[model samples]
Target: MSERRRQFDRDGFLVLPGFASPEACAGLVAAAERIVAETDVDALETIFDAKGQGHGRDRWFLDSGPEVRAFLEDTPEGPKRVNKLGHALHDRVPEFRAFSDDPRLDALVRELGVAAPRLLQSMLIFKYPRVGGEVPAHQDASYLYTEPVSVIGLWFALEEATLENGCLEALPGSHRLGLRSRYRRDGDRAFTERLDPRPWPRAGWRPLPVPAGTLVVLHGLLAHRSAANRSPDPRRAYALHVIDAETEYAADNWLQRPADMPLRGFSTPA
Candidate 1:
């Protein structure tokens, strides 16, 4: 086995520094800023409550699986603070598609044991200073579940992620703990269904602070969370979730694309 695969198997995650060029990171940051500037908050009704009971599920949030949409932060400071732009930024946005479809990603996924990697979801997260909400401990498999649990996440830091700006915190070898819950869609409503009663272990947890061009590879079941941003600098990141196409995607998964719009691989044209 390759050293990268061995490390991922043992740790459930990998930190690859300089995976993206500084210019690439800066361009993505500028693109995200432009998207936020152009977003019309007056028409938006979904306040993204990351820590709420519903977990930010709504018509706008649930139906954004196949398209690009903006979600606001759950803060009294009003609706201008966009928590993230998500679900299909990689397939719809030119800048994001270019960044996500790099040849390096294809090779990386292959080395990680994914025979055919399909892009499941993508998000441009904007943890605005002071108002960025906390993301609780959770696993990616809970959301984008597959029968055998074959999903990987590539999280790119568009800006330097620091402890002060709410960088990712995770349990080192948590993927072996099995799935804790599954986010299911029941018609128009969506909710999380518990699969395990045991809570995430607090021991061996660590904060992962990385530079702007760093890429954090996460196993699908890795328990991870981020605190609310308290610093003046914003924590901006781009995340892409990919799954092995050979696995069976749960039919009732909350985020589902239209039949016509199938998931694409890294080398596929947008």
Candidate 2:
């Protein structure tokens, strides 16, 4: 195995600086900005609960505008921003579609020894100033569970991710501890469960600050979380997750949406 792959297996995550060129990253940012500006929040599918289920767009907005607005927050100087634009972008946005199909990502996943890697989901995360919510420590497998737990996340930094702006922090070697149960949600947004009972020591968790265009690859079972952004600048990112196509996707996984196209160069199983 290559050194990078070995490092990933040991650390539960890998950070590659400048994984995407400046121009490429700029293009993605432009696309994201345009989509955010054009999208009618009321017309988009709403994920109102922690279980990741909600009434589809039509019903959520027209039928329950006041309740939904109560759950959302507006910025003092700018328009309200959703925490993330979910998997639907792979089909609706051209830039995201291209990024998801990038051959470089395929090569990296191949090095991880996953066979026939398939694109599981894509998200454009808007960690906007002040209002960007805190994500609790958790494993991706809890939501995107597979029988053998083969999910891998590729998080690309579109802007400077800093300690002041709520960059991702992770517990090294935590993936080796195996998957944990999902956190119980208290409301439309907050997590109620505590991480004190986990096997790893929280004191050893480290902050991972990456410059724009960097890529952070995460193991499915890795325990990771990010703080709420309190800085004046926004910390934006694009996260694409892939799974080994040969593995069986669990029926009970919270994210039951249909899988997007497999990454290029990986064979689709018959």
TM-score of each: 0.97, 0.79
Error of 1 at 142 (Å): 0.1
lDDT (tens digit, per residue) of candidate 2 on 1-270: 899999999999999999888887888878877766776765444543323333232233222311212122333365555766666455446677766677788899989867878776677777788877676677887666677989899999999899989899999999988666743323233232334455556588999999998999999999888888999989988888888878898654434442343233332222
Write the residue-wise lDDT of candidate 1 on 1-270 in tens digits.
Answer: 999999999899999999999999989888888887787877776877776645435888889988888888887766467888988988988999999999999899889888899999999989999888899999999989998999999999988999999999989899998999998899887888899999887688899999989999999999999999999999999999999999999999988899999998886865
Q: What is the C-alpha lDDT of each candidate?
A: 0.89, 0.70
Per-prediction tally of clashes? 0, 0
Give the runs in model 2 whose Cα sits over 4 Å from its true position. Answer: 42-79, 182-200, 258-270
Query: What TM-score should be assigned to candidate 1?
Result: 0.97
lDDT of 1 at 129: 91
